[model samples]
Target: MLRRYQTAICDALASVDGGSFCEDMWTRGRSGGGGCSRVLQDSTVLEKGGVNVSAVHGTLPPDAVTKMTCHGHHDLPAADGEGLQFYAAGLSMVIHPRNPMAPTVHLNYRFFQIFRRAPSERSGTNECGGEEATEGESLLWWFGGGADLSPSYVFEEDCVFFHEKLREQCDRCDPLYYARFKRWCDAYFRNHHRNEGRGIGGIFFDDLNENMTVSPEKFFAFAEDGLQTFIDA
Candidate 1:
């Protein structure tokens, strides 16, 4: 799914700018997995931009598990015990248009799963020297993502249009999603030291799962619509 998102977004941008993206593939080594990054520079419509996708798996350190627990993932195992293994996949993109009048846009959508390794698996290593916990049973999973615009100079009409389109997209899934995520976007993008928001808000959400009153399939659909919204906007 993430790969599909990356391809769609990159293709849309390339079509708009009439420029091709250079692809770069990278590996995570012992951590397992790799990803591809597509970047375009000095394009007709865009100054610079990249759409990236990655799927990585590895053990999370004790401190990382503690942080997740503190963030309300109480179901996670205790951090004092063996490290929890995890798998994460995501698509992220940022576009900087050649024209300053156009806003720099950013979008990211990701899925994460946590697992506990069996005792036998924990004691072994894979061919790559990474832990042999690839077959561990998943204990928790979630989806997270957001999209926002940041113009060098604010254009009220443009900002309003962007927010309205995002709101419309959110409404298709759940009427409450727009308001809730709008507030989250405004709050999340704020610069505490400067006491100002980074940009005119669009929509933001995180840690979304079945507990949030939506199934994983529903969330995936919403995320897919979000990418379409970005392309349209």
Candidate 2:
């Protein structure tokens, strides 16, 4: 599922970037699967951007857990608990427009996974069924994806429109969804090193899935609309 979806997103983005894509060098996962990292250097619409897709699983190593924690991952599941079954596919791109007037744009949308069941319980897992899987139960499923904008020069209208379009989509899913994620996005992009931020502000979130109150198909439509609005603006 992760590989197929990664291919789909790569195909869709390749058609638009107007540049040959190159795979990035990524370290093999300590736990399980690996990811395909693609980049477009000095692209027509970007400076150096990446569209990465990772389909990895297994328990996150201790180092990995520590790294995530350092990034304020106070909510990431434990590493040794049940050996999470992970799968993520998303497009992350930063368009550093030749015209500095055109603010830089960063967008990412991905699917996620957590510990659910053993290989037998879930079709994608390995033969080693963990203690939880042996108990005959499935893991909880969810999703998380969003797009944000950062203009070098503050464009209040652009920022407002960008957030508003995203808000509309969020409202369609759940009224609280937009406000919550919007605040998260604003805080998430802060550049502690610079004591400022990478750009003006956008949106950021995690833990979304097909089983949400809003169906996957509906969310897909909303995501597409949100992306289109961002591009069109």
Candidate 3:
């Protein structure tokens, strides 16, 4: 399971630069499995933040699939008399600052599964995808991860720098990708009920597969590198 690998990731990250930062842990029960959430804060740099890791598994009920409707992409398994088996593990984080000028950051990286690939699943055929590609293979065996920034105050330079770093990673695979996903990032982060975004946007991307230029290993490397940039920024 990815749970063991994810725990190793957290340990490696924390043992390195994150050790000095303040830490916290959080957990909750789920119909299937629970989650572990962690946080590291620096009084001078961040007001409060969390690095959460969750290991959860179970059949995704219909209500669960409906919740993702907002994403405009849903390809869950057929409702057989039996339930689907699924497992997921990953890290997510959010930083809210006392000083609004510095900007707030959010990040999430997750992996998921389904019993197996269903031939009838939609292929994510939208022409607007950040990376141009084909479909047929399952999106279920995949990883989704991205980091974004929202500043109460706009800092064009900071925004540009942030986007550029992410762009550098995406550009290595596809030049058009970074720009495409940047727009996606801006559109996805709104608090629709409130009719406002969390902050002036940074960048966000998800559902990346090994088929993408950034292979699983490379994706993690880029993600880790991006986290360092976020800290330094």
lDDT of 1 by residue, 65-107 (tens): 9999999999887854668888777889999999999899999
For each candidate in the order shown, give its overall lDDT on alpha carbons. 0.82, 0.58, 0.57
Q: What tens digits encode model 2's per-residue C-alpha lDDT throughout 143-187? A: 566777667778788777777777777787678888788788778
Ranking by TM-score: 1, 2, 3
Candidate 3 lDDT, tens digit per residue, 12-124? 44554344333333333323345555555654545666666665554556555555434644555444454444556566777676677877778776766554322233233
lDDT ranking of the models: 1, 2, 3
lDDT of 2 at 118: 37
**Deviating ranges (above 4 Å) for candidate 1:** 79-81, 118-135, 210-214
What lDDT is obtained when candidate 3 is compared to the true structure? Answer: 0.57
Clash pairs, model 1 backbone: none
> What TM-score would candidate 2 get against the native?
0.63
Number of the predicted model whose lDDT against the real structure is largest: 1
Regions of candidate 3 where Cα sits further than 4 Å from its true position: 1-35, 40-45, 62-77, 116-139, 191-198, 210-233
| Native-structure RMSD, model 2 | 6.3
Winner on TM-score between 1 and 3 is 1
